[model samples]
Target: MGETTTGLVPTTVRGEVEGQDLIMWEQLTDAARSGLTNAGFAAPIIDEAFMPNLESARPSF
Candidate 1:
């Protein structure tokens, strides 16, 4: 059987995850981290540059 994959690849002209995408990104990453832990895998090390800014109030989380 083929393997199942779950992931997100955000596309933006400004090269940033904002608005609805930003919220989804946060949720997806959180879920992924939890899932990885439950699966006995090391959590991913996310770079700050790749993450959205929590200070900016563009879209509510």
Candidate 2:
């Protein structure tokens, strides 16, 4: 997801996953980071609020 001063928005990529989604999220996040870096933006501080949710949502093996 991407957020601007106006509001939050979803990315064009969307899907359903059966297991831990961090790998997926990380990939997406990395892409975003790379984009920002390429555009000369500083490294972003991801919102910490999402961490707990991501951890809990991980698929237990």
Our model 1 lands, by Cα RMSD against the true structure, at: 13.7
User: Could you tell me how far off, in angstroms, the CA of residue 43 lies in candidate 1 after the best superposition?
Assistant: 13
Query: What tens digits encode model 1's per-residue C-alpha lDDT throughout 1-61?
Result: 3443545554556847565534444556777767644673333334442255444536766
Question: Residue 42's C-alpha lDDT in candidate 1?
Answer: 38
Q: Per-prediction TM-score, please?
A: 0.20, 0.24
Model 2 Cα lDDT, one tens digit per residue, 1-32: 44575444435555743344455445667777
> Model 2, stretches more than 4 Å misplaced?
1-46
Worst 10 residues of 1 by lDDT: 41-50
The candidate maximizing lDDT is 2
